[model samples]
Target: MSTGFIILALITIAGAIGAMNCGRLVHCALSLVASFAGLAGIYLQLNVWFVGVAQILVYVGAVAILIVVALLVTRNAESDRQNEGSKGWIAGGSVALLVFILLAGALSNTAVTGAATLAPDSSVETIGRRMMTLYVIPLEALALLLTAALLGAVVIALGGPKPGRASK
Candidate 1:
């Protein structure tokens, strides 16, 4: 693995850990954004420009903002600090570790990877042309939907009661 890849991986892992352990929902969402950015950087380093740009645009930009907005609009965030460290984390951690181990073993035993594959002649221009010519409608619809959802979340969050103890 390259040094840049190693750095990106460390950032990704650290962001993931932060997201999982954060006491506040907003912090978690931001950490997730960091993780997404790190992944995007890794994609860029791999020369998969389309996927890297998509990762930044779709995940880091839209999805992360949506998550933060949703968290802001939710009642759970009001009691964020109350649930800092859950007791069930140990069980969850153990299960996650088991899954990781199993996945590692399965991947090691697979013939999925060997010689590196040469990439096709993919470029930003071709991807843009395809999106504009063939997939324009779907892309526009998705943009509209995401915009509406973001607006709705902002409205809800802005109009909600101030952060305080939940009413009995």
Candidate 2:
């Protein structure tokens, strides 16, 4: 593996660990941003520029912002710690172990194959054209969806309309 790839992978892993283990939800969301950034770097290093851009746009920009907004909007002054017991840890560990075993088995059985590779410039241009033409509807729909989500988050943050107040 390349040194850049190794570094990106470490960033991804460390961010994921920090996100999982952080005590505060906002810190976890920030760590998730780092993880998403590392994944974007990995995609860029692999020469899939569109996917890398989408990774940054979707995960880092939209999702992480949404998470932080939700956390902030719903947070309480009281400590949010939960007293998780040993059984919870044991169950979580077992589930993680099972998932790891399943993933390892699937990866070990997969075969790598060579596929046709295109120039990055031409690929990006083709993608852009398609996005403007064939995929325009879906892209617009996604934008609308994100807008609605943001509006909903704002409404939630404002605790919805007052129960007994008249309309302005």
Q: TM-score winner among the candidates?
A: 2
lDDT of 2: 0.87
Residue 53 of candidate 2: its Cα lDDT?
91
State TM-scores per candidate: 0.71, 0.74
User: Residue 19 deviation, candidate 1, in Å?
Assistant: 0.6
Task: Provide the overall lDDT of each model, using Cα atoms, as 2-decimal numbers.
Answer: 0.87, 0.87
Stretch of 10 with least lDDT, candidate 2: 77-86
Candidate 2 regions exceeding 4 Å error are 115-124, 151-168
Q: Residue-wise lDDT of candidate 1 within 64-136, one digit each (tens)?
A: 9878877776746457776445558988989999999999999998887556678765698888899899999
The local distance difference test score of model 1 is 0.87
Which runs in model 1 stand beyond 4 Å of their true positions? 75-78, 84-86, 128-168
Against the correct fold, how does model 1 do in TM-score? 0.71
